[model samples]
Every structure is written in C-alpha cells, then in structure tokens.
Target chain A: MRASRPGMSRALVRRETIAGYLFLLPSLFFFLVFVIYPMFMCIYTSFFDSNMGKDAVDMFIGLGNYKELFQDKIFLGALKNTAIIVLVSVPTVCAFSLWVSSAIYNMKPVFTSAFRCIFYLPVVTGSVAVTVVWKWMYNNYYGIFNYLGKSVGLIDSNINWLGDPKYALWCIILILFTTSVGQPIVLYVSALGNVDQTLVEAAEVDGATKTQVFWKIKWAQIMPTTLYILIITTINSFQCFALIQLLTSGGPSHSTDTVMYYIYYTAFKLYRYGYGNAMGVVLMVIIAILSAIQYKLGQTDS
Target chain B: MTTKKSALYKIIAFVLVLILALLFTFPLYWILTGSFKTQKEINSTSPAWWPSEWTMKNYENLMGKMKAPLWEVSVPFSQYFTEDGTATVVSAGPQVPGAIRWMLNTIWMAVAAMLLTCLTSALAGYALAKKRFIGRTLIFTLIVCAMALPKQVILIPLIREMSSLKLYNTISAVIYPIVGWPFGVFLIKQFAEGIPGEIIEAARIDGAGEVKTFTTVAYPMIKPGVGALAIFTFINSWNDYFMQLIMLSSTKNLTISLGIAKMQAENSTDYGLIMAGAAFAAVPIITVFLIFQKYFTKGITMGAVKG
Candidate 1:
C-alpha cells in the first residue's frame, strides 16, 4: 500500500509505518500467540506419538497416525458420516433459506423483520439449550413425536428416535438444519433487499416469467452471498458435534459419529492425541480444498 | 418488484412462511412451557401442549443442585507478580446456587471479551484500512485467510498452550482466543474503509497525534461498527460451548450452557429439571439478542462482505 506522489516524503512514510505497527501490535500479539502458534502446533504434533500424558515424551512417528487412520474402522465410519452430513446439509440449507428469504424479503418492513427474527430464534437460544429441548421431543416412549404420531396414526408404536441407528443421524441432521438456516436466511434476506429493483422491473416488463427473472437476474446478483452461505453451511455441517454429543454421544454403534465428534472421542476419551491431531489435519485439508473449489465456482458463476 | 403476482401464489407463500415461523419458534416455546410443567404431565405419554400447573419446582431443583461463591476476584496474569508464583484468588461474595454463579460468570466473560475485541479491532482495523505500513498487505491477507478456517482444528494445540501459560481451566483461555479471532478485525476494517482518506489527513494536518486523531476523529465515526461487534461478541461468547467446555472443567467455572449440559447428564431422564436449566440458560441471551438484534444483524452482514 505504498503511495507515489510528487510531494510524498520519506519521513511521512516512516511515521505512518511506525503508527500502523503500533496499532496492529495488540491484535497481532493475541493472533500470533493464540491462533497462529496453535495452528502450527496442530500440524507439528500430528507427526508424533503424543499420547494423553502431559509430561510424556512425544516420539516422532512421521505419517504413522495418518496411516493408522485409514485402517481404523471407526475413523472411516466417522469420515463417511461427516461427508453425508456435509453433502445433505449444505445444499438443503442453502436452497431452503434462499426460498424463505425470497418469499419474505419484499414484504412489509415489520413483517420482514418479524419473520427474520422468528427464524433466528433457535440460534439465539444457544445450542445446548436447543439440543436439550429436542432430546425430550425425541424421547422414545413419551416424546411429542411419538405421541402425535400415534394419535394421527402415522405410526403403530413408539420409536426410540435417538437410540435407534436408523433415525438417529437423520434426527441430528434435522436439528442441525434448523440451527444452520438462521444465518443463511439473515444473509439472503439482506442480499435480496440489495438486488437491483429496476432490473427486476425491466425483466418483468420484457415478459420474463418470475422464475426466469429470479434464476437469470437475481441469482447472479446474489451469487457471492450464495457462495458464502454454501461454504459456511458446509463447514458447519462438517463440524456438527455438540448436538451429537448431547443427544446421542455418537451412540447406537457410532451411527452419529461425525469427524469432529470422533476427534473429541479419540483425543480426550481414548487418550490418542497424535491420532486426533492427524484427524484434525485431514479435516482442515478437506475444508481448505472445498473452500478453494467453492471460491473458484463462485468466481466463474458470478 | 412485488408486481403482478398471482393471488393464490401470494396466499400460499404467506401461509407457508407463517407455518415455518411457528415451527421454528416451537423449541423456545416448548422450553418455556416445559420448564413449568409438573413431573406427572411431563412423564405422560400424551404431550401436554401447555402446562396444567406452572410451578417453580424445576427452578428450585436446578438452583439446589450445586452451590459456589457468587464471585471470584483474581488477576489474569497476577501469578507472575506474586511471592509464591501463584495467583491470588480471593472470593468475597456469599455462596449462591451454581446456576446463578454460572450465569454471572457467563455475563462477565462475554462482557470482557466484547470490550477487548472492540478496542483491539477498532485500532487494528483502522490501521489496516487507513495506514500504509510495511507488512500491511501481508497482515491483512493472513487475517482474511484465517477467518475462513475452522477454529476447532487448533483446539488441541490451544489446550497445551493454555496449560503452559498457566491459563488453563480459567475463563481467560476462552476470552483470549475469542478476542484473537480476526472476524471482528475484518468487519471493522470493512467499516473503517468507508471513512474518507481526506478526513484523516485533515486531522493529521491539524497536528493531532496518531492516538489523539483516532480517539477524537476516527473512534466516534466507527462507533456503530464497534457497537455491532460488541453485541455480536457478547452473544457468541455466551453461546460458545466448545471453548468453555474444554477450558473450564471445574463445576464452579462452567458457563450457563455447560451448566445445562452437566445437569442433563446427571438427570438424563429428569425432563422437568433439565427444562429449568435450559430456560435459565436460553432466556437471558435471547432477551439480549432481541434487544440489540438490529446491530447483531448488521454485524453478521458486514462480516460476510470479505476481503
């Protein structure tokens, strides 16, 4: 960010540089110590046999943990579950939020904000609280789902939604969907409001149908937001842990084990720090590659 | 934009949004109502849409479960300054229910994080946006990239770092990382860029020192961004269960969310008591969010417009 001007002076540049670094010093300190340093350590420790003990000597076993990760059945299962969550959740969340935001963005001001706040309530309520309430709702014998199902003849008997492997992952996905949509909905509504009004009117006057106007005109305009929503939703779906931990603990034969949950289970519970760090590295690389692909797609489309 | 829509289409869309809104609000509604339901109603096969008896029994049980001193006053890095190389932790308040203590701790943590994030980010974001320093481009690039990466990947290493610094099992571990997160810096930088370069120049020509210029001319202008960042950080800090979960393991140090999780673990089938903890944790944060929601929305929206 250098300036080139007829009257620009070396002393002014020096003073500005000093001031800039001084201002950045505090934030840079915290960022380096907490974020950057830990990041390096996460990569560095993945090569070692750093078991749970704090004082234990970490033997360097380069690629050993990564090799073991491929052979571990539970780790592979977790990877599958993590992929399924990302694949299912990201698109659904994006489409559903886009639909909801389009439906309400043009409404009266009060109604628009009211709708937005209502959709975001679950998010504001905090995850732990929301997870607990849903646990009760999905209770096997006395859950509201079963009670209503029986009354309406949707099912003949009680179903253990969380305990049964068949429905457990789906149940976790449903809750994740609810919490995930809030931010995307907020983002989309704002983006929709910013859409070019005259362009929309021109398209309508040119006999363009509503769907054509949306897909061809409005969608391109909001593509950055769409990309943002997609990336964020994907990341969130991959890191889905609190819900699994609280409701199922990845139970019913590891049916709900996400990579994030598995990381916790391995490092903290199984005392395999090196293995956990290996999983963390793989997850990070996957996210980075996906985010890069998304960036490129968003670039080409927009 | 609202022109020439079919009446049926409009009607259907309206009805659908209404239904979805109701569905979305259900969990919070259930949390409130279920907290008041009697144990008999809760255990019944038929779901009670509303409570037959709105009782305070659940709250009583939640409060009775654990007790701790209401406040603990300790310096953050005071250990290095002390005689025995241990921080002086002095508890001065009367014993209160652990739920109440957790709530207080959560509020204190959120407020502290919010203040620190705002101050540090305002200074750094202003510099990045307005100053042409050496390494400015490098620092800005680092921040934008870091903002995209998942934070949990580094938790393993962060745990060790905190332990070595003697800040493990303390609230500062949670607060420092949150303060370090670059989202606020990125956001405030976006806001600060909108400030005209000439205004800063005018202040500089008037012989205002860098700090003086920022405090007087720059700070007031970017106050709204800081306000948004404050509310955003507060709500996030309050709900950040993972960091709180790992850093603060002791019973007395748990945040409200952790308190609820612990309660649920202990009383797995006790719906009434669990609901009480849920209500206690959810209601205050929800209330704060509703009040400052306009700013919070702005924060999220501004944060998305990245470098």
Candidate 2:
C-alpha cells in the first residue's frame, strides 16, 4: 500500500509537470515569437548599416553605428534632453503622486476615489487627444496660459510655449507629467492602505510627529512601493515619445528632441534603421542599469 | 492646540488636492468644450472658458472629412499570401461613416487584445503560481526583467517582424505586440497565487481531469484578476498610438486616435475640427474607464504589492 501511494504521487507530479507546460504553451509561444525574437533582432541589426531602401544592402560595420551615435550632435542633444526629462520628471512624479495619494487616501472613501478618478482623467483621455488640447492651450496668440498670465499680470507678452526652443521641452515635460501621475497615484494609494495601521499608531503614541512618522516609519514601510514607482516612472519618462511627436516634433532647432523621438525620426523618417537600433540598444542598457540599481536597493531594504 | 492646527492642515491639503485635480483635468475639459465652440471663439485671444455658442459644426466637418462604410463584415484572420496579386480576401460588407468605422476598428482591436491577454495570462499565470514546475522561477524572473524594459526599445525590429509575418499595416500587427507583453501575465500570477492548492488537489482526487479542473475550478477563482486585466488592456491598447501609427496606414484601418492625429496634422491650427476629432477619441474611452474604474485601479495595484 505504501509503495502504491509513493508511485501514484510520482505519477501525479509528472501529470502536474505536463499540465503546467501545456498551460504555459500559448503565452510562451507569443512571447518567444514576438518579444524574444524582436529583442534579439534589435541587438543584431544594430551592428549593421541598414536602411529602408529596397535597392540597398545591409553592411555589417560592427561598432560603427555605436561610434557615430556618440559623435552625432543631435543625438547627444537628445540624450541630454532625455536625461533632463528623466531627472526632472521621475522625482517630481514620485513626489507629486505620493503627496496627492497621502492627502486623499485618508479622506472619506467617496471623496478619495472621486479625487483619484479626477486626477486620472488626463491619462484616460489618451495622449493624442490630450496633446492636441495642450497644443491649443499653448498657442501663442489664443492660448489660455498667455491669456491667464496677461490677465493676472504675470507676463507682458504671449510666450510661444511650443515654438520657442527655451520653453518647448518644458511644455512637453509638463504634459508628460499630467498623464504620468495617474498610475503612480493609483499605486501609492494602495501602498498607503497596505501600510500597517498599528505601527503607525504606535509611532504616533511614541510622540513621533506627523512629518517624522511619514519620513521614518511609514516611509520605510512603503520603500518597496516607492522603489517600484521610481523605476516605472523612470521608464515612462524615458519613453516620452507621443507628446514630442505631436506637440513639437522635436521642435524649433531640435531643442525638444528626446532619444525616443529621435529614434522614431531616424528610423522611420530618415530611414536609418541600423543607427536607430543602435540608439535603441543604448537606451535599453541605460534603463536596465537604472532599474537594476533601484531594484537592488529595494532588495537590500528588506 | 495641536488638534486644531492639524485640522487646519488637513483642510489645506484637501483644498490643494481639489485645485490640482481641476488643473489636471483642464485639458479634457477644454477638449470637450472646444469641440462645441465656434471657430471665432476658438481663435479669440481671450479664450472662451465656456463656449459662447454651441454648435455641431466640428463633428460635421470631422465626419465629412472622408467617407467609409459604417461597418464591414469580414472573416477574422483571413490574411494570407495570395498568388493572384494579393487577392487572398475576406468577404466585404456595407458602407459606413469614416469616423464610426475608426471607432469600430479601435473597439475591435481593444476587445481582441483584452480577450487574448486575459486568456493567455490566466492560463500561464495559474500554472506559474499553482503548479510546481521546473524553470518557473527563471521564467518569472525573465518576465519581471522584460516588464521593466520599455516596450518601445524593440520598435525597429518589431516593424520588421510584423512585415515578415505579413501582419504589417493590419490590426494583427498592433494586437500581437500588446498581447505579447508579459505584464498581464505577471499581474495574473500575482492574483492567482491566492488560489489554494488544496482545492486543486481535491479536484484531481475527485477524478476531475486537468483541463476540467482548471476550467471549472481555477477560472472562476481568477475571474477578478482577468477582469482587471481586461479593462487595463482595453484602455491601454486603445491609446497605443505609436504602434498603430507605424502598423496601420489605410484610412479604414486607422484607429480613432490615429484618425484624429491625421486630421490635426493636415489642419494643424483648425482647433475646432481637431477638437471634434479629439472629443471623438477621448470621450468613449473615458466613459469605459469611469464605468470600470475599480477594475482599472485593481489592475494597477495588483502587480505592485510588496514588490
């Protein structure tokens, strides 16, 4: 009887293994063919001098495209712009969403969810719609910003919000900020709820002020959430493509060019497939490194 | 004194959040009102906070831009290599408004993506979460790493892959990539972990087959996760503009957002027409989101717990 039980259990394990793989087959098929293949092609094609012309041929000039990427002034400027975007937006998005979530998460449930819904409106509105509306709002002659500014005596003249090299990138960043906060706010609210209530009350009774509690106990508890938010927001900002594409098209003298936009411009517009893929590879490395660091920090915390 | 001060601070925070919410929603508010505003009002230096005269001219202009059939009936996935000059065809259907056609295309794409993502993710996530199998940790780790990487990084190659598969310029090109994304699976796995193994063991001991047990036992338990994934995938794939822009070009195939973008590009400063297009694209999705807001929120939160 004991031998039969052991053999039968082993057969069950085998059955589980078979069923597990069968369940995984469909998802794995799509993942392998679509994601894994392209990821490989992205790296492989980066080494060749490829173009979109039917008559042309791909020439393997290993490291050549990578070499040109560093020297390309427009690309370097775009890198700077992308860097600026990541630096400015990640911290601000994390801070802003955290602040809004903290403020409303403790409110009446109706009011809390209402506010959450409202803040998420822009994201739900979709980028093309939101971008066009913002484009109108930033119009030099008829913009609400200029009108409101003049009415409030904040400025003497209508500033070309999307036209000027100075303000173009900032305007794109502003739109990105509005759309990006929705997910983080959603995430933060849940994270706040998940924080242990008893620990928070203990801190309060032990004479920790609200600010101290937020900075110490609550903050420590939500570090993983914060880290997760940080990495996601970082990825989001790095891929700021739509707003730039619609609003400025990398704008007045390429001042608003992000690496993502530049990649689109190069590969699709200019037909420099190899060069664009090289840029893609670089971007992937940079993001992977940043995420790795954040992930490791998150790992060490626990 | 402390209580009073804290109450004042609470009030201040409430007011700030309210104001910020308004500011954030202002663009959508503008799109809604601008679509109904007069041309003169749209161009006026002093912007109209409210439309002075409401009219349907924008929608009229938008609808009149290009004429396509109101709806078309065709075989799903009938695309194949035709020897007769690309004549591998599906049966065609009636004439439709170009705008409504775009809406249909967008709806079809989003729904297909949602259904596929939920089905595939549920099965895979259940296996990963419940069934002890070799390479489970490795696969999960790979999914997490891939999810961290932005989807756009592989754009160049995806275009090539889609073209090679004869899916370029078709809805399938857009749908497959979104389905292929592993975030949905990761999310479902998180939710699926809550399923008790004892139930599955009991079902198996009760003589239920594997497929039968899964369909009857695992599926119902994971329905909420699937719901969240459905809503999330729908909203996201609806707004997946970049992929659509590259993949689908024919007027009839353009998603509503792409159609709006095309109209805006052609008539850059024609705010009224553009707003009408914007309104068409934004309002429906927003309505869907509002209706399923809880599922959407659950979709966002489910993946990040203690991560």
What is the per-residue lDDT of model 2 for residues A1-302, given as tens digits with 9 covering 90 to 100? Answer: 02123334777767777888999989988887888888888899999999977688999999999999999999999999999999999999999999999999999999989999998888899999999999999999988999999999999999999999989989988999999999899988988988898998999999989999898888988888888889888998999999999998998989999999999999999999999999999999999999899889899985
In the order shown, the candidates' Cα RMSDs to the true structure are: 2.1, 2.8
CAPRI grade of model 2 = medium
Q: Per-prediction interface RMSD?
A: 1.5, 4.0
Which 10-residue window of candidate 2 chain A scores lowest in summed lDDT? A1-10
lDDT for each residue of candidate 2 in B56-149, tens digit (9 for 90 to 100): 9999999888777665555444455453223243555566667888999999999999999989999998988888766777888888878877
Minimum summed lDDT over a 10-residue window in model 1 chain B is located at B1-10
| Tens digits of per-residue lDDT for model 1, B1-307 | 4454566777799899999999999998889999999999999999889998889999999989889888877776787688765578865578899999999889989999999999999999999988886788889889977877888888888888887788887888899999999988888898888889898999989999999999998888888888878877888888888788888888888899998999899998999999999999988988888887888778778767643
- The reply for model 1, stretches above 4 Å from the true place, is A3-7, B1-5, B75-86
lDDT, residue B251, model 1: 83
In model 2, how large is the Cα lDDT of residue A51?
93
Model 2, residue A212: distance off in Å is 1.9
